[model samples]
Target: MQVELNSIWQLKDLDGLNDGLYRVLQLYPQDQIVIVFPLVDSKTLQRPIKVGFEQLNEALRVGKAHLSSYELPYYQLQSEANISASHLAKRNEKYSLIADLISSPRFLLDLVEQPRIKLVSLHAKKHNTYVQNLYRVLNLYWKYGQEKNALLPSYKNSGGRGKSRVAGTKKRGSPVQLSCPSFQAPEGVNTTESDKVLFIRAMKQFGLKGEKVRYSRVYDKMLKEYYSDELIAAEAESRNALIPSYRAFIYWIKKLFPAEKLIRKQTNQGDFDRNKRGLRGAATDHTEVPGSCFELDATVLDVHIVSEFQRNHVLGRPTVYCVVDKESRMIVGLHVSMEYASWRAGRQALINSFTSKKEYCAEFGIEIEEDDWPCNHIPQRLLCDRGEFICKDAEDLAVPLIGHLSIAPPYRAELKGIVEHRFNILNEKLVHELLGTTKGRSYIRSDKDPRLDATFTLREITKLLIDEVLEHNSSIFKDLAKQSALIIESNLPPTPLNYWKVHVEAQRHALSRVDEAHARSRLLPISKVTMTSKGIRLNDQMYYDSSHSDFNDWKVIARNNGSWPLEALIDHDNSSFIYVRLEKESGFTRCNLMRESVNFSHRHQADILFFEDWIKLEKSKAKPTAKSIERYQRRNQVIKSAKEELAQAPSLDSKSERTNGMKARRREAILAQRLGEEKPELKQENSFSEFDVYKEHSDHKKQKVVSMLKRKQVERDEN
Candidate 1:
């Protein structure tokens, strides 16, 4: 019988229970109960009991107890009774009902006055029983004052050691315990110990390593080779026997060669080396301080998104590049796009780590304060894997701007565990809960297709990511800070924002005004361009500004050559301008595209890619529409107009090529001119062209004719 814990039982149901009111603490093969008496200490009732009968009867009459109800409980006891001290105590006569009933005043008085009141079994009317004689033994219990002496029968050898047994009666002895058996070697048929050794060795050689042999084939071959002297049985009872069973042979093979050892023997050295390295401590100690170290990595976001420009078109997964500060375990920067992890995406993520994110978040439609993500400082060192950071382009772009750049060994991700763990944290807490999420692996995902369920566009996902990152930064790091000594040193609340505030002042790589400009320019994607009078060319467009100091510096470096190749850096997020470095100077000059309002209207990289792809798709058709051609023609017209304006303007001579005497004369004339006086406007026709030498034909045509004559003269001279 079983009773539930903390439940009220009826008085009639208390017949089989112990004589006390009990609170059910646990239930299993037997009930675990505690007495609920108001006068006694609850600590004294800490010991569990099998039953409490009188306590239950009193509780049913009172209706309720002072103790609170147990809401949830678990009961786990042994399924089978084993010989323990508690079980032996329950069988003692002191707590037994027979002793209680016999010791009652009415039963004792009746038994003492009438010696003829015979003991008989209640269930069987004709037979006397141990229960009926309990009354007669109660008198001896008062004299002995001990349960053992009172319960023992008067007859010797109580367990029937020398008692006579009936002819049909069955005998029983003390029970023996059962347990699992030990392993034993299986003997081969018709083989001695030496032959068995040879057989086992042959089995291992044929099937264990190198080239594997089918166990069925080994069994068949063994049967054919049996009865030979080298493979003969030695036992007398079964001297000549058949081959052992296939199952038994396979079992022995498994016992001799374990799976783990076999895999280690067959696998390559690289796998073993990786496993050994993973067991050691981290190769880097980046938890010194916030902004002292950062890790850069990229992963495909779990949710599928569509192009913001095209609603029906399903863009696949977006690659999310993250830059994580090692000490605070906070994401310093993140960039999301359709491009895979490369130098382009890596540089963007790197720049974002050092730049204020307020405007970046605003561009994605999220309004966040700057202090919420106060991680806009240059880091002392950058850590990355052997992907983009190993490339020459990444090194050239990052090495000059940052202090130290280190790449972890191939196939070792634990070195950059900070960023990798943040990716996992984002996927679990944010991505998995959103719509169109793959929810990780196929076996783990539900039946719904992630691509079909996609509803958010790339723009929408960017906004969601901004909000998620902001929440992650501000949220309490209760578990992480409790374990990290560096985070606890901040002496503030355990959160990324709080930790950063306490430690940001200690950063050694704080950026100055000039250093900040240099860092931003270096992280932008670079392009080689020829410096023309109009400016540097990029993406089929010319970016120019005469007021730029770098333009004058570039002239000094390329005084002899009309045009020289120089690297121009571009901001992919803002196509409004570019930054170019002078060949002779260290500073960067921002150059705006010549006619942005007409042709390249300050569009982002995503829109540019869309336009290029759209043109390609239109051209792939058999015939393109007039509108498509007109759009292409309009773009070309704007570029052609900017060139015509630049060509018609007066060319300025290189100041570096001018003599010192000529510079002095020009400076005197500029000083003599009044500040407010207007200079005379020049007409389209030149006032001095009337006296020109080649006025009859245009100067260009005259130069062409002279070039023809000169070529003929050179040909005759060569002949």
Candidate 2:
């Protein structure tokens, strides 16, 4: 009896294929019939049928069948009279089981050969747990069987046994050595736990002795227990390596290849160079505004804050701020202070520059007629970038305070070349040279030992910066500033500064801090107080009271409210209130005298001016009334009870000669402080005759200068 299959029925044995085909063919009409199939590899289709490896066999093409389980090379069917595909497929084509291939039992019986009375034998394939190895099972009960699983046979002594080197019954505490076995490694072998267990079971099913796997049994145990999914997945992918779909490819790749290899495949060139150029371009343009540009940066100077002059006690590296002028190339107002670089520091820098500029103008024989910003008359401008210290809150405080200032675009540093160029020079000549050639990043550390100060002191550095700026402004140092200004004045049609003037005049009034609004606010009160760091309002205009710590940025606290007798309210935080300075020198003097008066007997009972005056007045007065004496006694009792004061007063005249020197020194110090005159350094030696110069001078030059100084006669005798 014979049955028919299509041109592409690939199989490993005829046991199932022959019976199925013979049964199906007998159900077809008595004549030969045909079926079509696609070309494919049979091994690939061993399980659920590999679509990519299908094939059309010529045996099936000839209305016959072959049970060879492999693929054939061909495409498209040749002759197909009885072969009809699934109703939806193309005519005369392919391996769609369009019709029933497996016949019924009755139909298959009718085609059987009568003489031999043959019945078909079927080998059914099913998925089940493969239990081949039985040694592992036997080891569970037999200790000798378990011991037999070792790589090296265990040695048994009279009393005890030593563990084997390769085939230990127990696991090692340290890392197990890894090695390949003597046997050939399995193809598509999963070097994982589950696969190892399966391999052991398979060997047991055959009743084999300990069969050495290609990899270590220790690793196999680890893989079986800990890496089942990975092992299964790896085995599946190895078995399905020929699949065409992306899912199949990825599954295999994930198992066989490292993750980094996939990443490398995804990335490309050309993207790297583009990013590098963008970063470099960003660092060059450091600022934002034009001539209205100033770089206000803070750093700690190379000095400790514990010095006698700086005991006010600020924290960390005491900060120093600088507002650099673009055009003048000058550090206008620099604060070597503890405070942050804020709007206040910015104002200080601007005010400092203008104050110095005023001096400059005065030197040039141009007395300022109007105390205006000189926006037009002086042709001055403020230039800087957008920063908290320079233009905080978007210049909410800066623009109005710095009159006639123009702001540049953010990050457009080339527009403010004056400052940038000056900073470049500073970096090359000052900061770099100071910090050290190796200090690539520009930073100033306030350490006791700063490398920059080896040749330059703090005072010297400040002087050098100032002198450099002055030299820049002068007809010296190559005259870049003068040349640039001249070139702008001569060419470029009109520079930004010159052209900006037209726009500035329109905005100039708005830039002033002192105006109608300020006047109504009572910003103006008095003007005669020497202009200083604390700017006071007077006549709707702010004036610098020079008496208030000239070069320092003072946080001037005002007292009570804005009123008469304006003074520095030094101990308050409210800046809006008017400052009222008490007569410090006089109060100080009185306090000192009172302290002396308490110890009058210490001076040999002789009294000083204030104390003597008090005593004389007391002695000359009439005797106190009963009520007055009682009140005085009560006050004395209270004073004595409150403090553990001395019992007796001092004698004042005991140190008369010593007192004269102190008095003279005090008087001189007071005079010098008030007059703002500097004194010369006093030499330790008193060898010089002060009157010798007077004696040498002509009558016209001398003429009893200073009542013919006391040293005159002494000098004459010595000569």
Candidate 3:
């Protein structure tokens, strides 16, 4: 007899029990009530039975359990109040009989075995025992339980009964209606077309920007202006349906218009545009293979990062540029710097995308495998917006290296949504949780200054970005629809790494290592400069290799046209070195600035700017002076004397020193050798020929140095 919700339960045999199946609808523990419906016929069900769980348990213990089961019929829900009110208002005779049958459940149960049930009505002259009336009462009980409203007749009077009752016509009760009313409208004046127009005008006024009038205020205004005291009285006297109840008017307003559409119409263009696409409608399925479409975009990072070199120097917000593969929704590459979104930043981000991230991770002390971030290949198509993306620098580099570069229309951010979404994911995973983060809109932002709360340096934030990117790529997304049989069969989880491996790996087109190096070389800015006797002149600085090889090797070419304009690749970040390739060389050679000691060596663009400012300040303070040659010579002599003294003096530790006894013996041996050994060696074993020495020094005699002609003549003579 115990049952679970929405489960099929069979009643045990009892003396008064009917043979049927019961479905548990709802259960109340404290009341021990188990409401169920009995399926008397195959399709239709009897009244929903309200039996106590304890009583059912007792019956089940004493009687045998039935095994047959049945499916519960679908019951549509509808309010019975209107029908019941109408029936009571009409003083219908059938309403009393139906109410009595529904109220007396035991009587209804007794009549279940009876062929017909007697209906006693005050309007009826004799007792009516029609099976149809009994069936109607039983059907109401089954559908709507024992509620008094269930006995009320339907509102629709559809029977074709003539209005004039003839004398010969059989006496009958009023026809019962089963159809629901078309409009269960409130008791109020109906609104007219003119009123709707007025309401629209009111809505427009209320929805104005910065005004944002409340609905209650708008309603009051409508009452004061459109439905004035004079109009209300006139409409009431004429029984005109002009003014509507507040509730009904509000309902009509909601039914006629949607909130989102209204907001879009009244809001600013920026917010309106976003509302037009919204969150749901903007998504586009990426079925293309990875590397075919890549989105490139940049955003200012929300978190504040300080300079690693200077702690107090808060670097402000750094711009982060990312390239996202559309197919896998993976962040292929990212660049974070204090620099804004410029072509230089975009170029660096592109290079990162085409290079393995393992080395990059190692730089940040994050141990990651090459496979963990497999997005190193150049994309077939690069998608970007119309910022630095269309600049000359990007065009020059991408045209030769990448397969294609595409520029999206202005204000169409959805075109590069993958990278935009990647930026959001990065913010959520790393930036928002960090200290000194402006997490939301400017108006809603906290009063506390994020710069003051900043804890991590630029390098530390870079590490955090790397970790977040790794997790984003490898973590299971679970966003793919599970209904696809192909996905289920593949057994691959919805992760960027998995998607890349499953779909993009098989037909992946990648650049070779040599090609990658060539691409990198071509991507850098190229400048044509002349090679002089000193070296390649770049601006005010002279650049050359250590052996002055560039001057020697390219000097002949410069001599051909008096000046050689060779192509030099320059990185603005580092000023000390520039790359130059000779006519015969396959790759460029790095040339360093000649006077590095005077210029403070290689410097980045920022350092160079600072250096230029220092030079300006120095020039402003410095004054020209005249000096005597004698004084200059005297100063040079003092420097020369200092250098000579340093060279002649023995160092602190001398290899010539020995112990006192060893030194004495060494001195005695040296003295003995100086006295006798020199005399024994007086007879020279051999001596250089005086004639040959005199010939080498003689003015008349000459000797030819070794030459190719001389070597050829000597070879012929020997043969």
Model 2: per-residue Cα lDDT at residue 117: 17
Residue 508 Cα positional deviation in candidate 1, in Å, after optimal superposition: 8.8
Model 2 per-residue lDDT at 147: 21
Candidate 2 runs further than 4 Å off:
1-336, 358-396, 402-424, 435-459, 470-719
Write down the lDDT of every candidate, Cα atoms only: 0.61, 0.35, 0.64
Model 2 RMSD vs true structure: 29.1
Task: Give the candidate order by descending lDDT.
Answer: 3, 1, 2
lDDT of candidate 2 over 509-565, digit per residue (tens): 112233322221121122222222334432222232333342234323343233233
- Root-mean-square deviation per candidate: 22.8, 29.1, 21.4
Model 2, residue 680: C-alpha shift (Å):
53
Specify the poorest-scoring 10-residue window by lDDT in model 1: 70-79
- Residue pair clashes in candidate 3: 47-142
TM-scores of all candidate predictions against the true structure: 0.48, 0.27, 0.50
Ranking of all candidate structures by their TM-score, best first: 3, 1, 2
Q: Which residue runs does candidate 1 get wrong by more than 4 Å?
A: 1-278, 281-286, 442-449, 478-491, 506-514, 528-567, 574-577, 580-586, 591-604, 619-719
